[model samples]
Target: KTAVRVSCGEEHTAVLTKGGAVFTFGSGRYGQLGHNSSQDELRPRLVAELWGAKVTEIACGRFHTLVRTDSMKVYSFGRNDQQQLGRGEDSPPSVPLPVPLQQLCATSGLVIENIFAGGDSSFATCVHKKDLCRRLKNDETPPSVENMVDTWISGCDSKLLKKIKKEIHETFSSASCMNRSFLSQSKDKHFQTSPDYPGLDFSLAQSVFKKLLKKEVLSTEVQAAVVQLLPALDGNPVGVEGLRVFLVLNELLHVIQKLKKQPNTRLAEEVAAAVQKLSPENLQIIDSKVTDVYKRDFFHHLFLRIVSDKPEMFMFNDSETLVWFSSEASEENVVNFYLFGVLCGLALYNNSIVHMSFPLVLFKKLLDVEPTLEDMIEFSEAVGGSLKYILDYEDDDLEDQDFTFKIHWDGMDVDLDPQDPQKAVTSQNKKQFIDAYVNYAFNTSVEKVFQEFQRGFFQVCDQRLLKLFHPHELQGMLVGEAVYDWEVLRQ
Candidate 1:
């Protein structure tokens, strides 16, 4: 594979091939290309200076380039802007100069493996094989590359990371509030909240909510409560009932927001229980307003017990959930139902011991009837909101690995003959289907849907379903696209 690095100078880029060859392009004003040339190179040009040692990695900063060799040595050239080259603040080097990263590695007894350069900063990795060996020997615990990196970068202190995260949340929350107030005065009703809000309407909100709920960052009970509260909000005016509904919804929203800021299962369960108590009739009314098939399906499934005395089973014995996405059901209802399936899958995945028995059942119900790619995409987007919820509790060791979600398309041809030698293929197909469903359910984008659910819940309950409970302070938590985050982790 070829590794590429771009210089902060914005005029230069570097590429290193698996064959240990180095190439550079863009401005060579500072000889950052290490080719002893002052002229700018428009296209990739070979750097003969790095011909000896096999260069494993390359990094560049403004007017500077850094190279790491297979021997664990480091080489630097060009301007030392902010001393990013790890060289002392002196005159710029005219030619490629070797730097001693070995001292830094030796001090920590780590082997330098990688290097990265930013505009005014530089980062490097030192593999602590001995330390990992020692840890493995002392305890049965396995060593992870991520853990090693974390240790090298931040001493691997979970507590310190938590503190940093809290600081970030406070900063973001303050910024969001300021932005919300400013936008509220705008003529556009949608922009009344933050312009950057992910879920612009009820359909969007429901989609995000299911994703978060699935990750177990938000709970089913909270979902049930939101469903219960919708009808009450539909009829009530801005009176005592309205105020109570608002408060309760706001409180729930705040809890969700906080959980999104930092995921906690306990908080999710509390929210879930509150939602469970909400009236199903109210949710149906809200679903009607949204005019989406997904939302309606969600409401129907969630409140099946209250709607009809008998439980309306959606899943079959084969572990498929059949959903008919048609013009008969509004887009909103369809999207909502899709999100609900994702949520159920996420919830079960989080607490496997408790949910293992039901995943197949849930999957069977959702997949029994073939849903289109459009439906799957919408569902995937909804689940994307809750990615943080799933990632928050993931094992650090697995953080750098790719997560695969196997989706089975009904249209895709597969040989299913009983006498075929590839009987295992059928089993694989089943596994992939289950995995895709679960992955989408636990995705981060679901958090955005959860936020929308909070808004709709309060609005519907206060306006229509007020008699069941009084409104109290409510909070809305919104999480944005998190699939990107997952991809980054894999990289």
Candidate 2:
């Protein structure tokens, strides 16, 4: 048989064949040979116990062997005095046996990708999948909020309840939960449970979340509970809870939006303040060491969900936080590029939703803040080069083409100085405040933002924004050269 993979212990060897079989040889002092007795194998011996399963990978310890199957099942044999094979029991098995880690992995919400072992210790790297897909694959019914509450109560201790209450109290009393430097951390430092509250399981926490999403519950109480419970999410040893966290955060967002209209102004503001803290910078923290495809895609889907489900939230609130990383600052942490990629991806994926909103301004600010052509190109590639198309276009030869521009000056004072030191308009600061106001007007003679770009008044933009344009709609920049010059004169 063709050997696909091979690993060796201190005095034994294990080989994975292309046909999904394992062959063992050499020392059997600790049952490492996988035979029925502690006898050395002079020749390659097929691991008969694993005859039905196809072994995809293999790892050998000092006196034990670990193998992973094509179906993600893991098995082990040999020395178990140190529990190196991960069987829990101290007895060594003379034949290859399944590791039985599926239950633990499932509870933690991770897909086992690979097995690792050495020096009497072993590990299994896990990946995170989209929560919705995982639930479907597992055939789990979406438990009702009442059911979830009962489940939480049944599984958790009094300490967890007290902790949850304490978190709520602290959150409402705190001025704000927004962390300005969230993107600057070199390690995974997002929401986490306090060390004192031990044995908090993902299932129990998820049930609490489902219960909070129900309309029958008091919004304030649920809001407080969510804020308090967020930290416990940090307890994810495997990345399975990545999807759970995403869902929790999204549900909490809806709660905040509803709370904004409630009568309790103090509680509403507290909830809003806490909501603001859940920016891409904070929530998108990923462990660099994790190489699991599911875990990575989990975050990717989370970003997409935020942009697609709540475009305005990302455009007005989370998009503004991109300024936390200058091109230089981004180099200090990979999360900068990762979050930016999400923003770019957001614009690309939800181009129609964000086109009339603040997305273009976000692109402009990112181009300006990005320190290098490489980073700029990376940002551009993230959005499929639509950004570059917007930045570089010729409108001079388009005089014959009909164009319109729309600028919202609804709240601006005509006399405000654009050049005043106290009112100085930084490029990003301008984009941050004005982009939302910069929108397409759906009228016969409506002005367009692109005309300003053609006239060398507004920055250049491409036809991507035109995706929002109607057949009768005008296509031009919102600000005109005359208006721009007038503003300069007024300043």
User: Could you say which candidate leads in lDDT?
Assistant: 2
Residue 422 of candidate 1: its Cα lDDT? Answer: 37
| Candidate 1 structure quality by residue, lDDT tens digits, 1-491 | 44433334567878886578788887888778777877888778888878877887888777788888888888887776567667755645645666767887788778875787777667887779686567658886533322332332352244565453443233223323212222222234432222123112333333333343444412443344445444433343422222223223333344455445554334334333333343444323222233232232232233333222212212222223322112223435434443343333222222211111222212222223232323343344433233333334345443234333322222223232324523321222433433444433322213344333334434323323322322110100111122346777888
Candidates' C-alpha lDDT = 0.44, 0.46
Q: How many clashes in each candidate?
A: 98, 19
Model 1 residue 217 CA deviation in Å:
28
Over 4 Å off, model 1: 1-9, 88-92, 132-491
lDDT score, candidate 1: 0.44
